[model samples]
Each structure stands twice: as structure tokens, then as C-alpha cells.
Target: MTAPDLEQRADHIVEQIDRFVADGKRVVLSSSFQTQSLPLLHLVSRSRGVTVYFLDTGYHFPETLEFRDQVTEQLGLDVVSLHSATTKAAQVGPHGHLLFAEDPDYCCYLNKTAPMETVAAASDIWISGVRRDQSETRRQLDEFVVRSDGTTRYHPMLDWTEPMIADYQERHDLPRHPLDDRGYVSIGCAPCTRNIPGSDRGGRWFGMEKTECGLHVDLVR
Candidate 1:
């Protein structure tokens, strides 16, 4: 879709969110505060009372954590921080040291997905910043979806492109993730993430085939 088209779609999405809020639905936004996440964060910030969920995986770069806090404070967001039941040290006891290297998927399940499942159990709507252009796995996702758990998963920026995101951030003066300046396009857990050229998600899970952290994939199940 063109930039104009995506902007129109974004407007419609905000309207839908407003309507959901008016109807007293429990709406929440899940954000990673990555390079492309600011636009969606800005969008949801405009709607009062929508709680933003940030998965505190305990392994994220210090820069990411700082940026998350900056965005929360700057936007005055109603943010809810989520963390795994197991501590990193405790997880290592059972899964072995460097569990992310041994089994990234399972590690993600423990840290990311499990916390989100708890959030999904209580939320009626889940707003996310996922865009089709980010990865092949996300390309097939619909802008609006009904999860198996009965929560409505809404992707307000599903049709957006990198240029659109840059434009929106510039227009709104939204803060960029600090790691983005260092060429880290897709920021996540520090150990599993790196700098890769061209692709936005190329840095994620570096050598492995894993693209998504289980949060997006498992939330529907």
C-alpha cells in the first residue's frame, strides 16, 4: 500500500480503538519499542486509558530498557510491565546455561509468550505494532484477527512500510529506540540480537530460523 493509503488505514484503526474504548472493552497494546514501534505507540497514546504492555524479558539491552522508559514517560502511557515467572538464573537451572542458544524457541516461550498469555487472559483486545514488511512469518497475518482465546488482536500498522514509519515518527517527534542508531533494526534480547544490514528483522535470532518471539505466535493458541 502507498503511504497515503496506510495513513487512511491508520485513521480507521484509531477510530476502531476509540469505539472499543467507548464500549468499555479492555484494550491493551503490546510494544517492543523497536525501530518501527514508535508510530503505533504514538497512535495508542492518543486514545485515553489503553494500557500498553511491555515484555520485560530480563535479557534486553540496557539501551532498549532506557528507551522503553523514555517512551513511557514522554507519551504519558498507561504502561503495564510483564515479566516471566522464572528468573534468568532459575531458567538456566532447568534449561541449562545459554538456553537461548540451545533452544531459542523454548526460551522465548518461557520469557515472552508465557507472560503474554497471562495478559491475554485478562484483556479483551490486544493491540500490536506488527507490520507485514517486517518478516515473512508476519506477512500472512490479517490486520484484524480473533484469537482462539477470544481476544481480538488488532494490528494498526500491519500495512505500513518503513518509510511510513519514519515519516510518522518525524511528524510526531517520537523518540527512536537508542539501538537503532547503532544499526540494530530489530531489537530484542541482547544476546540473541545483533546488527544486520538491509532487513529489519535480520538481527533477530542471528543464525537461527526463529523470527518471532513466541508472544505473537502463541497468543492465538
Candidate 2:
């Protein structure tokens, strides 16, 4: 897509967001604060009163936290941190191992999906920066998804690719996550994240069959 196409697409998304707000819909955005997430963050920043929710899973890299803080300050966003109702110490399995080691699904449920379900249940629209080309699962996603609970999941960045993100970042001079320079293209919890060459989501969940952290799958269910 050319510069004009990108600008038009962005304007369309902003128009929809503004329409939602005009209708008195409660719009909320969930961000992971990764480098790729900057485009959507910048897009949403065009509107006012949209609170950005970050799920602080208690297992994030310190650099991810710092990036989140830096982005929040830079964007002048209304950012809110959500945590699991269960304490980190309480997230253990039968063998006294951390739930992420024995049962990643359960760990994700406790840390991310549950907290986000609450936000989705209460909000009229939930915006996320999930791109289609990033992973197979996300490739099946649509621009707007109305969940079972009646909340709309909007993915304005769904059609955007890595090159588009890079161009936008360069154009806007957005800051990148510190780990991005080290090859952590798709940032998540430190334990399940690694540096995998040539694939956006290859490092996530490392060797596990699971790709998503359940916010995209289970939260809507």
C-alpha cells in the first residue's frame, strides 16, 4: 500500500472509533507495548477518552514494563494496568511448580484471560493490535468481531504488515521496545518468549502447541 492508502485506512479506523464514542460506546484498547503495537497505539491516541489496558501478567520482562511506561508517558494515554485476582505466589500446580511450567493455559487464564474478560464484559468495544500476518490463528481473524458476551473486538491493525509497522514507526519516530533490538520481535511474558528468526510469533510459547495466551480465544468464549 502507498502512503495515501495507509493514511486513508488509518482515517477510516479513526472515523469508526469516533462514531463508537459518539454513540456512547465504551471503547477500550489492550496493548502489549511491543514495537508492532505502536501503530495501533498511535492510531488510538488520535481519539480522546479511550483507556488503554495492559495486562500485567507478573511474568513480563523488566524491559517490557519500562517500554510500557515510556510509551504511556510519550503518548499521553489514559492507561490502566490489569492484574490477576490470584496472586503470583498462588499460581502453583500439583507438583509445586509454577503453573506456566505444568499448565500454560491455566497460567494464562489466571494471569491474562480472566482479567481481560472482565474488561470485555464491561466495555462496548475492545481494540487490540493483533495483525493477520503475525500468526496462523490471527490470519483467520476479522477486522471486527462481536464476542459471545456482546462486546466488539476491533483489530484496526489486522491488515498491517511488518513493513507497514516499520514505516509508521519511522514516520512518527515512535520508540521501540528495548528487547526488539535483541530479536524479541513479538514480546510477551519472558518465560514463554524467545528470539526466533524470520517469524513474528515463532518465539512465543517456544515449544508448546499453544500460540495465544487465551485473551484472543478464551476471553471471548
Candidate 3:
């Protein structure tokens, strides 16, 4: 998309957000604090009372934590950090290895998805940075979707491509995640992520068949 096109989309997003706020709907945003997350982070910063939630799964790279803190401080974002109720030591399997090695889905549920469920249940709108160009699963998502629990999953940047994201980040002079320079495009937990050569979400979940960590699919009712 061209710069003018992106600008138009951004304007529409602002209007939509304003309408939601006007309706007195509780608005919340969840971010993974990656480079791709910057555009939405910056956009939502313009709106007041939009609390950004970061699920601290206790498995993120040190750089990711630093990046989250950096962006929150720089943008003055009202970020709330959520952590799993389960202790890291208790995330182990019967064999004493991490549950991610045995059952990644269950591991994600306990760590990432479960912690966000309560917040999503109470909020009227949940803004996401999920882009169509990121993954096959995300490509099927619409700009606005009401989940089973009545919380609307809003994807304002759903149509944005890789180039558009890069252009926007450059235009805003955004601070990138430290791992972005090393080809970690779609970052997640350190053990599940890898250095893929492209901008898409191929780096996430690595060799596993799973794509999403279940925030988009299972976090709602």
C-alpha cells in the first residue's frame, strides 16, 4: 500500500476507536512488544484509557522485556503486565522437562492464553496488531470481529503488509525490538522462536504445527 493509502486506513482506525470510546465501551490492547507491534502501539497511544497488556510468560528473552519497558517509557503507554499464576518450576512435565517440549498447546494455555482470558472477558473491545500478511491464520481475520463472549476483536492494521509496517516504523522513527535486527521477525517465547529469513510469522512456533498461542482463538468465550 502507498503512503496515502496507509494514511487513509489510519484515519479510519482513529474514527473507529473514537466511536468505541464514545459508546463508553472499555477498550484494551494486547501486544507482544515486537517490531511489528510498534505501529498499533503508536496509534493506540493517541487514545486515552486504552490499557496495553503484556503477558509475561517468564520465557521471553531479556531483550524483549527491555524493549517493552523502553517503548512503554518512551511512548508513555499505560501498560499492565500479566503473568501466569503457575510457577515456572510447575510448568514441567512428568519427565521433569518443560511442558512446551511435551504439549505446547497446553503449555500456552497455562502461560499465555489463560492469563488474558479474564481481561478479555471483561473488556468490550480488544485491539490487536495482527496483520493479514503475518500468517495464514491471521489472513482469514477481518478488521472487526465480535467473539463468542461479546468482546470485539479489532484488527485496525489487518490489511497492512510488511512493507507498510516497515514504512510506518521508519516514518515514525520507532524504536525496534533488539531481536529484529537478527531476523527474529515473529517473536514469541525464546524457546519456541527462531531466526527465519522473512518478515512473516514463520519464525514463531518453529517446527511445530501450531501457529497462534491461542489468544485470538481460545481467549474469548
Candidate 4:
């Protein structure tokens, strides 16, 4: 689809969100403070009724945490910092050894899936920034979907492309993620993500046949 078509769909989704709030719905934006993720955060922050939540995975790059604080204060966001239920004793040291190599999915569950599930328990509408052009897995996603886990999901930017995102960021004078210019178009936990050159590998967890961090995939099934 063209950029205009994508923008129209995004506007439509935002309008629906506005209406949902007017009708007393509990709306939340599950943001990661990614460069592209900021636009939706800004959108939700404009309304007092829409809440924003993010997981503070212990493994996040220091820069991500800094940016999260900066954006939250700048936008006057009532952001909830979701934490992993597993204690430091269970996650670290020699005994557990989760996500050292083949157990990336397990690690994702603790850091991404679980924390989000906890925060979303009380929310009816959960907004996401997933876009179609980001990956083949994302291409199959619709603008609005109901997950198996029960939270209503909205992907306002589902059909948007990288160029479209760049334009929007530039127009709004938005800050880019620190890693965006360093060959990493998608950013997640520092260890699970890497730099990809050219127009390839748009998804995080690339080169491993894993397109998601267990958050989206767990919901699909």
C-alpha cells in the first residue's frame, strides 16, 4: 500500500482509540521507547485517559533506559514500568543460565511477555507500533486484531514502511534511537539484537528464524 493509504489507516485507528476512551475504555500503549515507537506514545499521551506501559527488561542497553526517562518526562506520560517477576537469584548466576544460547525464547518470556501480560491484565485496548514492512511475520498482521490471550490489539502503523516512518519522525522533530544510525533499524535487548546492513533483516532476532521476542508470537497462537 502507498504511504497515504497507510497514514489514513493510522488516523482511522487513532480516531477509534479516541472514541474508545470517550466511551470509558481502558486503553494502553505497550511501548518500548523505540524510535518509531515514540509517535504512538505521543498520540496516547495527548489524552489523559490513555495510559502507557513499558517493560524494564534488566538486559536493556543503558541508552534505552535513558531515552525512556527523557521521553516519558517530555511527553508528560503516566508510564508504568513493568518488572519481571523472576528474582535476580533465578535469572542470574551459573545455575539458571537462561538465554545463554538456545534458550532465547525463554529469556524473552521473562523480559517481554510476562511483564507485558501483567500490565495489560487491566487494559481492554493495547496499542502496538508493529508495521508490515518490518518483516514477513509482521506482514501477516492486521491493523486491528484480537489475541488468543484476550487483549484487543491495535497496530495503527501496520502498513507503514521505513521511509514513511523517517518522514514522520523528521516532520515532528522526533529523536531517533541511538542505534538506528548504526545499521540497526530494529532495536531490542542489546544481546539479542545486532546490526544489519542493506535493506535486509528488518526484524529483530534476525538470522535465527525468529522474528519476534515471544510477545507477539505467543499472542498469535
Q: Candidates ranked by lDDT, best first?
A: 2, 3, 1, 4
What lDDT tens digits, residue by residue, belong to model 3 across residues 1-221? 77888878777787888788889999999999998899889888877778999999988999999999999999999999999999888899888889888888989999888998889999999998888777677778887888878999888888888888889899889999998778777888999988987646788788889888988764322
lDDT of 4 by residue, 172-217 (tens): 6777777777776667877777777664445456667666886666
Best by lDDT: 2
**Model 2 alpha-carbon drift over 4 Å, by segment:** 218-221
Off by over 4 Å in 4: 1-11, 92-102, 148-150, 199-203, 218-221
TM-score of 2: 0.96
Estimate the overall C-alpha local distance difference test score of candidate 1.
0.82
Task: List candidate 1 segments past 4 Å from native.
Answer: 1-7, 93-95, 218-221
Q: Per-residue alpha-carbon lDDT of model 1 for 1-221, expressed as tens digits? A: 55677678668778889999999999998888886888888878778969998888888899988888898899889887889898777676354676786777878888888898888879899988888888777888887888877999988788788888888778668888887777777888898988896668888888888878876774332
Over 4 Å off in model 3, which ranges? 218-221
Q: Which scores better on lDDT, 1 or 2?
A: 2
TM-score of each: 0.92, 0.96, 0.94, 0.86
**Clash totals for all models, in order?**
0, 0, 0, 0
Q: Lowest summed-lDDT stretch of 10 residues in model 3?
A: 212-221
Worst 10 contiguous positions by lDDT, candidate 1: 90-99
Q: Report the Cα lDDT for residue 205, model 2.
A: 95
Error of 4 at 64 (Å): 0.6
